[model samples]
Target: MTGGLPLSGVRILDASHVLAGPFATYQLCLMGADAVRVERIGGDDFVRHHGGSAELRTQGMGGSFAAQNAGKACILLDLKAPGGRDVFLKLAAACDVVMENYRPGVMDRLGVGYADVKAMKPDIVYCSLTGYGPQGPFADAPAYDHIVQGVSGLMSMTGTKDSGPQRMGLPITDYIAGLTAALAVAGALHQKRATGEGQHLVVPMLASVLAFMGSYAIDAQTLGRERGLQGNAPFSGSPFAGRFDTVDGHLVVTANTAAQAVRMVRALGLADLEPLAAGTAPDALSEADRARVAEALDRTFRTRTALEWEEALGAAAVPAGKVRGLGEILAHPQTAAMGCLDDLPLPGLEDPVKLPGLGFTSDAWTRRPLSEPEAPGQSTRDVLAGLGLSRREIDDLARAGAVAGPGLPPRSA
Candidate 1:
């Protein structure tokens, strides 16, 4: 993976845990960076024990943790301890990037904050992912994905009016923040390479959500558009841009342009609505007319299966698709064509775990095959040994509750 990617040979110390910070470092790993996750001594990432079923969590390969931490090495150091902090600073001096997702003052109190790290590594890109920025009224308040979702108005914009505000099923904000952090870190790395200067980055989930919702807020301010739940409908209220039920399942048909509307109406056997399809703004239709057309379309769509409608609409070049579940998506032919999923071996699991790889691909570079996710402290001894710690010193640190490694007793507080 390190062969020809843009971030090849970049060394990163990933002191982040759970989703957001870990995912940022994971992105760097995909770009061929030598990213190592430094776990707390004697502790695993909360995600490792929080998600998935009891069976999976007991195996210590909770689905979420495995997905986010794939392709990274794990080492443990009790940074509160003097010996451990020294080892961390040593690693910082040798690495290009140091990343964490601790709260604002936690890192400073731990004595491994950016200022502390910068003194040891003059050209280090230090990135922090926090719930809110370093200084804000809510900065000190603890935040997670769902809390930010509600605070950012994202929850208000989801679901239908009847269901009220509904949270998105996944940790969307966390993933978005992680992706943004990765991009920011990459830019900082590029600048450092060119000018020999490092950077301190503070990425906040609140800021990331606002950025993601920028267009929405701008539209409200500039166009007097009110934010409201529209369910499966497009915000524009385009009649064609909604879901309709078929015999078996739902089909999403989006015909935004005049030509697309024409094709869609013609395909659905609703020629009477052809004029409306031909550049007629949805609001131009009377309520009666809109209701009549929706009724007709719904009746017609129910005559066939979702797949049947999808194929028919596709043939007419009107954008359409059947709403699919995860199982269907995994079985779909397009999923195979995308080549975005891989099966990696995991310890104690009988079957190789299938997981999504990079969201995109490049002709110029290829991601290396994924290695299984590592257990906490899985590579501690090797990492310390690489840092010039002798076997006796490494063993001493383990014995003194300052460090942990594979097969060694977890350090006690």
Candidate 2:
């Protein structure tokens, strides 16, 4: 394990918004990168105004925005304004990385695209995250998580036979794209360190989602069949590997191996059913045998509570868990032990807000001190100053409607 955060001293100029782009930069910030996001002069990130909590939304710290944007600064710049692009270019020159998620040509139209930034900072690692690849037929099409989910065939395969083409409960594609972009940026940064040469990373959400569903895609192509929604059933096709009803709740058991299937049956006190699995290969049971085993297990599981079955199956080396709600899981002892939530102190809120911490733990990685998500343009003055702009120049820019921030005079109506 390393002794400190790996990306310390790295600087990211983030012009991304919504989930994917912000999330990618947020991941890097969690690893100790100094990230400064540039919002439009009068506009905020879409997530900044929408989320579960109305109060937070009104405060410009919506729950969705707070989820991944902690520890980052914000500056507001109207790139269409006369000096706005100049200001962005200056910031880009000082940044080690520039990340944006605008559509294919929006950044170029604004005169702050990858080419423009690369011209200023030859070794800058630039990442352009979009819905589609930069040179595709659909490159100009706008997309959100749900759009990508539909386009990538994820929605088509998600639900049961009765509820066809259902969307996932969460914005899974956005998260996948974010993770992919973060990984690409990390790799590019590694290469830059090694060779002092930067690279442009074009991460498309559609491609990211497709890669995430590689297994299913390959299966569909190889078997020439679509495995329509099996609904809670493990893709491995084990009859014993799925959600089953219990007296009090539900339990999910994944007995994916031959030994595990046998052990699960035995643990459930279904000795009569043991023969069905004793010599059979996992996922290779005959249709009749599969139905029989599944029926027996389902009937037996109903005799006890989900937790009771979880304990018994777990002790028998079966992979099992009781279905839990978000609140229950968050409050679980295991979650507490993981220390994956950080308390952030926002200015207006009476109590500190709890946000997620680094998703993984390592002995070598040190946790950066928790910082609150910035309100739009919260750090405009300081960030501009860091770019070597004088107070007079910043004030002039604000007056000219090119920039806006707290304590600065509002842009002329």
Candidate 3:
């Protein structure tokens, strides 16, 4: 699986948990990095016990955890316990990257912060994912995806003005931070390869979201104007570019350009509205003109089903798509052809678990075959053994409460 992959031979110690941290390491894992998840003894990651699947959640392999945790080894280590810190240092010395998402100074308090790990492995790519940066007024402030979305001003622009601020349906900020961290780590690794030097990377969810809304943020700051909530309307302000209802369902259209707007109206059999849409600029129409054009589009779109309109508008080279549910899109043939999902056999499950794969394909690199998401500490003994600990040593550590996992001796009362 590692052959010809970009991250082959790369080793990462993932001490991070939950969405953002775990997702970053997962991306690297898909690229062929060998990732080892270091979980606390008797304390599982939050996602391991919570997700959409009740059965899987009870088994401590919830859907959220399973989605991003495949292709990694799991090891339990009570870093506070005796001999635990020593074991962590040993693994650090052998790994190329160390990832964590604890609040600022939490790792320092635990004696495994960047400085500590860097002492063990001088040229290690250490990344810290947090809500804010390492040092800031909000550095210690708690944050979740929704909170960051609001704080980053993303919520301000979502939904309709009448509906007020709205959070996105998914944890978009967390995923953005995860992606940013992954890219930063990849870049740091490249620099390390060239200069034999390593560096610390700090990825903040709030900053990631702000960066994602870069143009909007800059416009708001420079022009003192806010797009606010315009519902499904695009920033282009084209009357033809927005969500419209069809006979059976709804679809979104993005006919921002004059030509595309003309094509869209013509495709919908509204040639009379073409003059209103053929303006040189998106906002060229007056409010009255815009209202007239929109009303016409609204009424014309209702003549066909959303899918029918999608096909018709698409054939005319106008950007449009039927609004679809997650399940519907996942089952669509277009999605299947993209190879963006994989089914892996989980150990205790009767059927293979369907999880998302890489977002894109490339001719230069192929992802590794995904492994099943493991139970907490599922590979503890094996990982310790790989660190050169003997079977007796592993059992001693388990019994001493330094580690816990399957295949380890039960800790004495």
Q: Mind giving the per-residue lDDT tens digits that candidate 1 earns over 1-413? A: 32398788999999988899988998888888988888886675778876666776877778888887887778888987758888888888889999999899898888889999999998999999999998969989888999999999898889987999999999999999999999999999989889999989999999998998877899789988756776887655667768999999999988877788889999988898887775446586788777877888888999999999999999999899999998779777898788787787777768886677788887888766788888778898888889898988888888777788777764545
Error of 3 at 409 (Å): 2.3
Backbone clash count for every predicted candidate, in the order shown = 0, 1, 0
Cα lDDT tens digits, model 2, 6-114, are 9999999999999999999999988889999989976746798777477788888888888888888888899988799999999999999999999998999899988
lDDT for 174 (candidate 1) = 95
Task: Report lDDT (Cα) of residue 117, candidate 2.
Answer: 95
Residue 275 CA displacement from its true place in model 2, Å: 1.0
What does candidate 3's lDDT look like per residue over 294-386, in tens digits?
888888888889999899899999999999998888889998889887787665778885577789877786656777788888899999899
Worst lDDT window (10 residues) for model 2?
276-285
Candidate 2 — which residues are off by over 4 angstroms?
Answer: 278-283
Clashing pairs in 2: 2-364
- Model 2 root mean square deviation, Cα atoms: 1.6
Cα-based RMSD of the predictions, in order?
2.0, 1.6, 1.7
**Model 1 lowest lDDT segment of ten:** 404-413
In model 3, which runs have C-alpha deviations exceeding 4 angstroms? 1-3, 280-282, 347-350
Q: Counting only residues 3 or more apart in sequence or on different chains, how many pairs clash (N, Cα, C under 3 Å) in candidate 2?
A: 1
